[model samples]
Target: MPPAQNTAGPGREVLTSDDIDRALRRIAHEILEANKGPEHLVLLGIPTRGAHLARRLADALERVEGTEVPVGSLDVTMYRDDLRSQPTRAVEPTVVPPGGVDDKVVVLVDDVLYSGRTVRAALDALSDLGRPRAVRLAVLVDRGHRELPVRADYVGKNLPTSTAERVMVRLAEHDGEGTEGVRIAGPAEVAP
Candidate 1:
C-alpha cells in the first residue's frame, strides 16, 4: 500500500487498521500466555490512546479467556521528568480498577515507546498508587531512541528511526473515526 500523508508533512503509514487489529489480538494472546490465565492481572493505560488500546486488549482477552480483565488509566503527568523543559500539560485522571494494584501483575500500556523516560515516570506514578507483585510495559510501537534505561516487554511493531522522526498513532477511539493507523513523519530513515 502507498504511504499516507501525515499532518506533520510527508509520512508513511506503518500500520494500517487491519494491521493494528491483528497486532493487538496477538498481543492479547501473548499477555494471557505470559501471565498464565489473566488472574490477578491489571492493565493500566497511560491516558489518551493508550487507554483506548487497553480497553481493546481487555476485550480481546475476554474473547479468548471468557473472563473479564480489569483495565484502567494511569496518568504520569506530574511524574514526568521533562515537565520543566516541555510545555505544561494538564494532569489527566488516574483510575485504578477495583482491588487496587496490590499483589497484582500490572501492565503499563502506551501507544508508542521512544525514550524510556515516560515509562520511568509511569513507574514513579504507579508506585504512589500501590505496590504490585510485578510491573510490565506494553506498547503498540517501539521506535528505538532510548534516552533512559527502559524497554517494552510487549510491543506491536518495532520501527527504528532517527530521533528527528515522529511516530503518530491515530486511533478512532481517540482521534475519531477514519483516522486509524500508525504513521512516521519527518526526515528519518527506518532501520532494517
Candidate 2:
C-alpha cells in the first residue's frame, strides 16, 4: 500500500488531535484494566503509524501504573497476502523489546482496522517471534468491513463506512509537521 498523505482538498477531517489523545488515553486505561496492571504486557505496533501509537500507549501506561511497559515494532510487509500482487517494498525492522514475547499479553496496535488483512499479516509475523499468553488488538479507528473473523479487543471509534471510502489516520509522529487527525476520502479524491 502507498503511504498515507497529508494532502489538502480531498478527505474531510473526521477526528481532531484532541479526539485522538482522548481515545489513546481511554484505550490505555482499558488496556491496563483488562490486563490487571501492565505486568507482563507487551505492545507491538504494526508499522508505519502503529509503531508511533504503540510508543504513545506505552508512555500513557507508564504514567498511570508507574511501571514501564515494553513497546516494539512489527513489520508485516512480507507476511501480507497481497504482496505478490503489489510491487515489492522494503522490509522494515522488527524490533522486539529486551524481553521476548513469551508468555506475555501481546497487544497489537494499529491506526485503523479495515479489511483485517493487515492484522492477519501481523499475526503471521508475530508467530515467528514467540508465543504470547494471549493476543489482543487495539485500533484507533474501526471502520467495519472485516473480510476475516477478526475483531479489535479495544477500539477508539467505530466508524461505519462504505468499502469504496478510505480511512486515513494522520499522527504527528508519523505524518510529520501536520495536525494529527482522521479523514475519510472518497474514491475519486484518493490517488490511485
Candidate 3:
C-alpha cells in the first residue's frame, strides 16, 4: 500500500499520524472482509478510547466500502470483575441503544487489548443488552500479555511487548484533534 497521508491537526499526539491511519485502513479492510463486506454489522466500542476508535473505524469503513454502519459506546466498568478490588472506583453507566442486538453481527472494538479483562466485562455487558447472532472482537493494538484466553477477531497491529510496556491510544476525540495519533509506550509514562 502507498504511504498514508495523516495530516495531523493541532493537538499533541501519542503516535504518528501515518501509523494510525495505516492501521485503521488495514483494520477497515479486515473488518469488511471478515464479515463479508459489512452486511448487518454493528460495532460496539468499549468506553473512552475504544469508542473513539470505533467511530474512526466506522468512518473508515464508510469511506472504504460506502456502507453506513451503526456504532455505539459501552461502559463496562461495573461489569468488570476487578473494579471493586481496585484502589479506585471505576466509572459506569453502560449504554446500549434500544436497537436490539438479536440476530445481528456485533463487533466489539477497543483501542488496546491487553489482559483481556476489558473484553470480559464487555461480554458481560453485551449479555445484559441482547443476544446477537454473532459476536467478534476488533482491536487497534494487541499488546501480548493476556492473563485470559481472549483473542481479537480482527487486530490492527500485534505489537509484541513485555509486561512493562503500555500501549496508549491517543485519539483526537479524547485528546483534542491533534497532529499526533495513537501510540504505545512504557508503563512509566502511563499515569495509572
Candidate 4:
C-alpha cells in the first residue's frame, strides 16, 4: 500500500484502518486462546478511545465464540501519580459489568502504551474497584519509553519510537469519521 497521507492533520500514517482491524482481530483471537475461551473474561478499556476499542474487541469475540462478552470503560485519572505535575484532566465514568471484576480475568485496554504511568495508574484503579482472578494489559500501540516496568500482554502494533516522537491513535467512534488510523509525528511535526 502507498504511504498514507496525514488527512487527520499532521504526521505520517503508520497503521491504516485495515491494519488496525487486523491487529484487533489477532488480539481478540490471542486473548481467547490465552484464556481458553471467553469464560469469565471482562474487558475494561481505559476511557476515551480505549473504551471504544474494548467494545470492538467484544464484538470480535462475539463473532468468534457466538456469545456476548462483557465490556466496560475504566477511568484512571484519579489514580495517576503525576496529577500534581500534569494539568488536571476530566475524569470519565468508570463502568464495570454486571458481575463486577471479582474472580474474573480482567483485560485493561488502551490506545498507546507510552511511559507506562497510565497502566500503573490503571492497576491502582483496578485494585480500588475489585480484585480479579487475573489481569492483562492490551494496547493498540506500544511505543517504547518505559518509565515504569509495565508491559502489554497483547499489543496491536509495536512501533519503536524516540521520546520526542508521538504516536497518535484516531478511531472513528471517538475521533470522528475518516480519521481512523495510527499516526506518528516527530518533534518538529507534532502539534503543540
Candidate 5:
C-alpha cells in the first residue's frame, strides 16, 4: 500500500496529538501495572508508521515508569501479498537487532488497526527473528473488521468505519515537520 497521507475528509478528528499523548500515558500506566515494570519488555514496532508509534510509546513508558525500554522496528512488506496494490515502489526496509527476541516480552505497536493483515504479517516476520516468551500488541486506533483473529492488548481508540471509508494515521515521526495523529477520508477521495 502507498504511505498513508495527512489529509481530512468527513467525521471529526478521531485522534489528535493530545489524544495520542493521553492514550500513550494511559497505556504506559497499564503496561507498567500489568507487567509489573518496564524491565525485560522489548518494544518492536511494525515498520513504516508502527515504528514511529512504538518510539513515542516507549518514551512515554520510560518517562512514566523510570525505566529504559528498548524499541525496535520490523518491516513486513515482503510478507504482505498485496504488493501489486501497493504504491509504485516498495516500502522501507525492515530492521531488527542482532540479539534476537529470545524470551522477551514483545509489544508490537502500530498506527491504524484495520483488517489485522499487517499484524499477521508482522507475526510471520517475527518468527524468523527468534522466540519471544510472549507477544502483545498496541494499536493507536482499532477500526474493527479484522481479517485475522489478531487483537491489540493496548488500544488508544476504537473507531467504527465503513468499507467505503479510509482511515489514515499520521505520525510526526513519519509525516515530520509538524504533522501527526489519525484521520479518515471518504471512499471517493482516496485511491481505490
Candidate 6:
C-alpha cells in the first residue's frame, strides 16, 4: 500500500479531558435510559483503551444509578480478519463478568470507531461466548469511513476525517501521555 497523506498538521487536539469526561457522562445516561435501568447490562471493552473507557463508563453509571455495572475486556485478536497479514500481537485476556453475555444487553465499548473492522471482529468473538438479548456499541470518537456496516449506538463525538488521517486517543490511564484527549494526526510515511 502507498503511504497515507497526513490531513492534520502534525497532531491536533480534538477533545480535552473535560470533553471526554462529559461525553462519557452523557453516554452513561443514554445507556441507562435505553436499557430502562442497568439490570442485565454488560459493558465489554475492546482491549487496551476500550477497557479503560469501559471502566470509566461503569464508574459513571455507578454514580448515577448507584448500581455496580459489570465491566470486562474482550480480546478479538484471534477473531480479526487481518490476523494472517499482521505481525503476531500479544493476545489480551477476555474477561467476561460472572454473568455471561446470555440474555444480557452487551455494550461493546471502544475508543474510536474508524473502519469498523475492530467492531466486526468483536462481534465474531462475542458469538463464541453466549448470546446476548441485544448488542450495542459505544464509542468515544466516531471517525467516519466504515468498511463494515457497523454503527455506534452511543457516540461521544462524531469526527469526520480523510482516509489519510489517523485518530489517536490518549488517556491518562493507558497512554500515560500526560494528557487525556483525542488527536488527529497525519499518517506516518514508510520508507521505500
Q: In TM-score terms, which candidate is top?
A: 4
Query: Alpha-carbon error at 55 in model 4, in Å?
Result: 0.7
The residue-by-residue lDDT of candidate 4 on 1-192, one tens digit each, is 999674577788899999999999999999999999999999999989999999999999999999899999999998998888875698899999999999999999999999999999999999998999999999999999899999999999999999988888999998889989999988899778
Look at candidate 4 and tell me the lDDT of residue 77: 92
- Which whole-number lDDT from 0 to 100 does residue 93 have in model 3? 60
lDDT at residue 129 of model 4 (Cα atoms): 88
TM-score of each: 0.92, 0.93, 0.84, 0.95, 0.87, 0.91
How many collisions per candidate? 0, 0, 3, 0, 0, 0
Cα-lDDT of candidate 4: 0.93
Q: Which pairs clash in model 6?
A: none
What Cα-based lDDT does every candidate model obtain?
Answer: 0.90, 0.92, 0.80, 0.93, 0.82, 0.92
| Candidate 3 global lDDT | 0.80
Backbone collision tally, model 4 = 0
List, residue by residue over 1-192, the lDDT tens digit for candidate 6.
Answer: 999864432478899889999999999999999999999999999989999999999999999999999999999999998898995877999999988999999999999999899999999999999899999999999999999999999999999999988888889998675667888877663212
Q: After superposition, how far is residue 165 of candidate 3 from its true place, in Å?
A: 1.9
Ranked candidates, highest TM-score first: 4, 2, 1, 6, 5, 3
Q: Which ten-residue region of model 1 has the weakest summed lDDT?
A: 4-13
lDDT, residue 136, model 1: 91
Residue 97, candidate 3: Cα error in Å is: 4.7
Model 1, residue 143: what's the lDDT? 96
TM-score between candidate 5 and the true structure: 0.87
lDDT of 3 by residue, 3-48 (tens): 9653443222445767877888888898888788887788888978
List all candidate RMSDs to the true structure: 4.0, 4.9, 5.9, 2.5, 5.4, 5.5
lDDT of 1 by residue, 65-173 (tens): 9999999999998999889887568788999999999999999999999989889999999999999999999899999989998989999999998888878898998
Task: Give the winner by lDDT.
Answer: 4
